[model samples]
Target: MNSSAGRDFRVVAVQPQWHAQDFTSAGRFRAWMRSQLELARPHIAGDRPTLVVLTELNGLPLVLRGAGWATRLGTFRRAATALFVVRLPRTLPLLLRERVSPIRALQLADADTNAELYLRTCQALAREYGVYLCCGSAPLPRYYRQGRRVRRVPGVLTNQTVILAPDGHLIGATNKVHLTPDEQTGGVDLTPGDLNDMHVYPTPVGDLGVAISLDAFREDVLGHLGAQGCTVLLQPDANGAPWTSLEGLPPDPAQLRDQPLAWLDSSWKATTGGRVRYAVNPMVVGNLLDMTFDGQSAITGAAHEGQPQSYALTGPRGGFLALMPWVETGPPEQLRETGRQLAAGSGHPHENLYRTGVLSADLHLPPSRVTPPTPTAHEEALAALLNGEGEWPRPTRSGRPAAWLALLGLIASLTWARRRRDGDRGRACAPGQRPR
Candidate 1:
């Protein structure tokens, strides 16, 4: 790896499909990994680029998706059959399997447990891969409140982002501040930290800022990256439906109003010259039906006033790899001139008072950070609701007709049971005489 930096470099972003069970066994996953490295290895060996970035969950999800049971037999059948082919029995113990074996409680679901296993597996994969891999976040254990000043005991859960470099070295990581609603209060009942925060990993190439899905949606988050000297931003996301080619589809004329990309263009024009690399690698949902990932991976980079460049690879509805070159852009700076030019401009007729140029709002300001304020319990709860957390509300106890009918039915059933018992007692007493 190139430990020092200079110009004339290349970068490969690997977008591997990670949904189904094809990548479960050490052999299958390692094969996929080898293929990805083979495709991009030349660049690294040739010293074209010193870094290789991989998407999150490149191994574990494939295994979990493939695990299953045999019909009529009590024993669970491994979903992936390719395990023995690749010598995985020897490797399974090395895997991160905390979630698969945790003490099951009523509050924890299979999904939560699997997520934990996924995290453990990721750590193991990073150690073995020996590349700069941005393993995404998994939840960690935190204190949860049951209700009314009662606190549940703390234990580890799955949550948080992880990054590993080549040779299995850990870099920096950031926990997601803005979780999807289900991840917030109630469902998993997690407490969210402040927003507008980021973790900057200073690599040999340059500083990289990593964020989760919703974190990218905030303008403040973007600002935080720009101000902190981050030249590239990486997002490991599982967002909307995975897309195939947009070919043969007609543009919607009614929806032809200006969109955000256009605004982005204008913003770039107004701003000082600086380059920002934004990459989004979302898990492709379509290819998972057969318990497999459709490595429909894509990457997009936006340069100031330049055509947005993107690279993608979608294939055989399973795991595939894509490697693309990326040019690193530095932060902005002011213009300078020689002494002779300065002297010449001092007496120039056009340089009388003010400089003649188009005024740009973006150029006038300094960059800032995006950090959200700490939230109160009530506010957090409401935010959780917005994020799709909380229990389903029950029917109100107000005396509406339905409520009254339910109440009446319940009372009638209780009264009838009591009367039946009393009648039996009365019959016995009448036959015997006044009972002692």
Candidate 2:
């Protein structure tokens, strides 16, 4: 464990109310972000190093400026799908032609200008705030070196999360490895990165790890981070109602309830085993086109006696900062035992507050052991499947041939039975049934 494990740190999770007009100019978006920082300033009182987390795809608005389709369709879901469908034929050729060429496909979408502006704004904000900042996730085309030349595969993009240091220098970045079906159909066509390649950023308070939106729902991702001895887990999300569907169907109503929070709590405990001292989830709020985001940003940790506690923002909009005390982790054996008990369905001993509006809290962080857990073969296989490296075991194909043979036999038997019945009926009717 790092010597600074016992040091306290303050973190501000900003849940901003986004507007379409803000994307008209980079300055407008910066101004909106600055306002959110200002709102969080009062709550962030401490000399300790602080980290500010923004929501997933918070930079999307800036990247989508001047999109003609956005103006006409007036909804992100519809606009994105329509744009992709309209240009699909043309897009396929470019994708196939440039499949091996080192060229960014952003020009086809006309998003280069906005992408540059969005990145610049994030760097500026990190420098201005002088805090470790998670600049949120953005769908950007990235180039990598192949042999001696730098190249990008066309028509492929990664939803990347950038981490900036206090001095505005790039520290770490990771791409969202899990893409929802809606995102895939909406022209996002994101390339998933390996979870093992995830960066663990060293911070003053603890080692921090990031899981963007849907990635957070995967237990393997969280477990891998915990095994790496990450003390803080940052999850940036943009959860909303009216989920985008390829079939134009409405979302399940149960999804809009408090079920997400329950899932978050359960997943955290199951993966981290109280090893990660702090878990912060910041979600985006407000309406973007027709989608309305639900902002229930939260900070959760275990209490002194191994009970979980959480401070959440239940409102639809706003910001919250939590000043958390650093507590040294317990032994590895104890953490494993705690995890086992939790897995046995022992409920939480304490209640958490579902807070609304602006809120602040000074909570104690649970102690965790930094010993990296050695995964078994089964665990490794599961991780590989989740990371898309290995395919899930399908039922044996050997049964297929047998099934087909059985079907053929049944068909032949039925044919013979029909023929015999017809022959018998004809003979009886022709020879004797006429006399009766």
Candidate 3:
């Protein structure tokens, strides 16, 4: 929330610390979040419009808080199973009422509890701080709110990104429209968000946009939101890869020496198109069960896109407003040296990676574009397809078993996290940075 006399707006990016202990109790989670928000209070007291942002999946681990005895389990699957056993009384009613698979019922039960905790905690904090807040993405099914009650809309869970106003009311929400191979095929089975209905929300500073993780890389989703006159883009992230890996990067003569920053294109390059003036990428860092999320959070400007990029891809001319220190250094290959070797090389406990970064900067923002907020061509086409303007393709008999296979694969994988190799999922967006 830092501001200067002539600045048009301000951004406070909270690169949050994620750990099971924080969400073990309602008081702990709220207190942890409140302290995080307190870091923004210094920047928010002025007339300048300020927006506070958290990283993607910032609230996803809240599930561990509500799921009974989950924090005590050694791995995710074990915790989930323990959760079912611990909450059998509540879950039995859901099973009888919905008659869905045990897995599906578990997801619904999860959505029923954790989503509210995430929303209420964020809403209350936004109001207390009196600042606009983007609470990152949470995994929840489609839900409707009716006078303090949240009801499920009978859909698979989606990575839902929500923006809250200074008064603490929800401004708008968007879901992840692109699914990684793991998200779709993984047992989690997240639902991809539709593009046609996506739109920008009005903020005091300008129109705000939400593109959680891979959705920021999507042409359709970005096109639709850009069409709606979005000025600032929020690409909240929790990359499950090492921050410095250079896997799968497209060659830029400029990037061959340092390919890590190439992945910033998901947001930075997208802004050079002129519609988005600024992009805020706040990332979560820490271990969730055996999974890890690491990254250096940043706020970059489009006007500086023409400037020579820094290794961090930031500066005043269209570079970074602020960039956090990276967790690892040196070449991606050296860093990727065998898993055991890599693990042994680092004496610092992974818990040492849980540094909470609070970055605030005053930005001289542009006037919002005068274009009418309208659906982009991609959105229209998608709407048409969904409206039955085109035929709905039926799944083949061969495709029928895919769900069961994905579920089995997910269960098998989740059953033993120690055996799961570390690659870049968070880094997958970065190209070959994800390990093979």
Candidate 4:
């Protein structure tokens, strides 16, 4: 049993630069997503499966897809306000039923539409390429299967990561057990997932684990997934601030690692000790609805050791197999400058970081991962057509949809949702309060 001959798996982290237009419409969103997948296709060969992981929030922009005004607005505050006014009739109910503010209600209302746009696109791509696609993470009302029907759980929403098999079937979904500061109260206010709910989905490559963004930083989530026998870990990241900025000081600031160094810890440190052999961190780049995210995608192996305490993304360091080209490894000032440029919204600077690229490594399946799993518990049948699959899901609440008028609120609902969620903690700036 030669390990070299058993090289049947590859992992490619797709660092995508998302913009408002990419999610302008269902067709446009699919096109943009497909183009990114095309970039990863080169890493596939020999009929061996490749795991393509897109960065977090890579598809979350769908909330703004059909809403022209939201995308055109400079800040999400004005956008949310406009959208709220237009969709007050629909948003009003959600606000009351869910006992949430305007922002959360907007997000809740648009869940079904965004879910459809995201799931449909990813599934098609997974089937077309015949690769295992970690469709990245999105905040949507909790979707569960009811016999052949797929329905959203009324008020519940989670930042969920979904995985699709080569056959385009949903293999598994893991929720972000831990929420970042920005995702909690007075923020997006999404429900945090419980650790008990984590699932390790088996793939051609191995038992796969997906930890969305911040989840990779904590041991609670990593340790639990490791205990479940994950060999490959995917940390789909959407670093809220710039990639070079220092991490906020926790209670114990004395032991903090700065920026990429903290991310590197997610590399070797996040493997569930030696149980998880490899980790892939795909990062999102670009400013979506004014909330910017930027970072270098990275892949790490457990076998490589004795790396420099500090290393740059110029090449592989420590156990990193590949890190996308990122030269802004700097003193926070660089990130601030990038922010300034973004504020101007004029020309692109450090433009390479926003280009779609793949950081991939082909590896021999470890002995532990070679054995495929025997079917266990009840697997949901590849969901039924589910009320509507072929058509772009309508956002209307009721009635024979008026071609023009009925749909106005629909677009505004989604637009407002994204604007609220896209805003830094639900508001760009408070009344008379300056934004840093």
Q: How do the residues 114-166 of candidate 2 rate in per-residue lDDT, one tens digit apiece?
A: 44566567777777777777877777545433333333345556677777677
Ten residues in sequence with the least summed lDDT for candidate 3: 391-400
What tens digits encode model 4's per-residue C-alpha lDDT throughout 209-325? Answer: 878877887778788888778878889888765554445433343443445666655755664247478888888777666565666787777645434333332233466677676
Candidate 4 global TM-score: 0.80
Best by lDDT: 4
User: Per-prediction RMSD in angstroms?
Assistant: 24.3, 19.5, 9.1, 5.9
What would the per-residue lDDT of candidate 3 be over residues 1-436, giving only the tens digit for each residue?
Answer: 2223323778888887677788777888888788778877876747777899887766666656744467666666577555644544444344446654444445566665566567778888888888888888877666543333334566467777877777765567778888664455333446788876577866665578888877776777788888778778898887765444444422322233222364565666676556577788888776667555566677777645434444332332355667676644455455443221322124444443444677776666545443434643322332233233433222112232445544543453344233223332332344223311
Q: Considering only N, C-alpha and C atoms within 3 Å, which residue pairs clash in candidate 4?
A: 23-65, 24-65
Q: Which residue window of length 10 is worst by lDDT in model 2? A: 427-436
lDDT by candidate, in order shown: 0.36, 0.51, 0.61, 0.66
- lDDT value, residue 312 of candidate 1: 29
Best by TM-score: 4
> Judged by TM-score relative to the true structure, which candidate is superior, 3 or 4?
4
Ranking of candidates on TM-score, top first: 4, 3, 2, 1
Instruction: Report the Cα lDDT for candidate 1.
Output: 0.36
Which portions of model 3 show Cα errors greater than 4 Å? 1-7, 66-68, 89-104, 145-150, 246-259, 273-275, 303-318, 328-351, 365-436
Clashes of 2: 2
lDDT of 4: 0.66
Candidate 1 vs 4: which has more TM-score? 4
